[model samples]
Target: MPHLEEHVSLRPYNTFGLAVQARYFARFTSAEVLRQLLALPEV
Candidate 1:
């Protein structure tokens, strides 16, 4: 991952097209990093 914190937000999403931030949030450049990101407590 270039940066794990990229695109993360505490602000209310300005759209109703999605469910929630954490519900669809993810950041990783590879499967290995994806596994690590999915394990995060905040994921």
Candidate 2:
């Protein structure tokens, strides 16, 4: 496996305006599942 470095950025524009490690991937079984996942705060 390849090394996964943090997804860093100088500007933090999230709700808190703070730096947070960006998520790389998300998996879903179907369209319904994807929609459910999309409703999540971290999606």
Candidate 3:
């Protein structure tokens, strides 16, 4: 599984720098990894 980042800020990813936050975030390199993340209950 990919490393999960908690309380991630959305500013860097957004077109406009908005100060929003995410409870959990992960970066997947493959469809399998994405599926694994989707399978988690927290997701």
Candidate topping TM-score: 3
Compare candidates 1 and 2 on TM-score and give the better one.
1
Instruction: Report the lDDT of model 2 for residue 23.
Output: 50
Model 2, position 32, has a per-residue lDDT of 76
Per-residue lDDT for 1-43 in model 3, tens only?
Answer: 6677889998999999999999999999999999988898887
Task: Give the residue spans of candidate 1 off by over 4 A.
Answer: 6-26
TM-score per candidate, in order?
0.39, 0.39, 0.82
Index of the highest-lDDT prediction = 3
The lDDT ranking, best first, is 3, 1, 2
| Model 2, span 1-43: residue lDDT tens | 2222345542455777766665544545678766766676644
Off by over 4 Å in 2: 1-24
The deviation in Å at residue 39 for candidate 1 is 0.2
Which model is ahead, 2 or 3, in terms of lDDT? Answer: 3
- In the predicted model 1, the residue pairs found to clash are none
Candidate 1 lDDT over 1-43, as tens digits, reads 4345644553565564553444345546788888877777665
**lDDT of model 3 at position 15:** 94
Model 3 stretches astray by more than 4 angstroms: none
Model 2: C-alpha RMSD to truth?
8.7
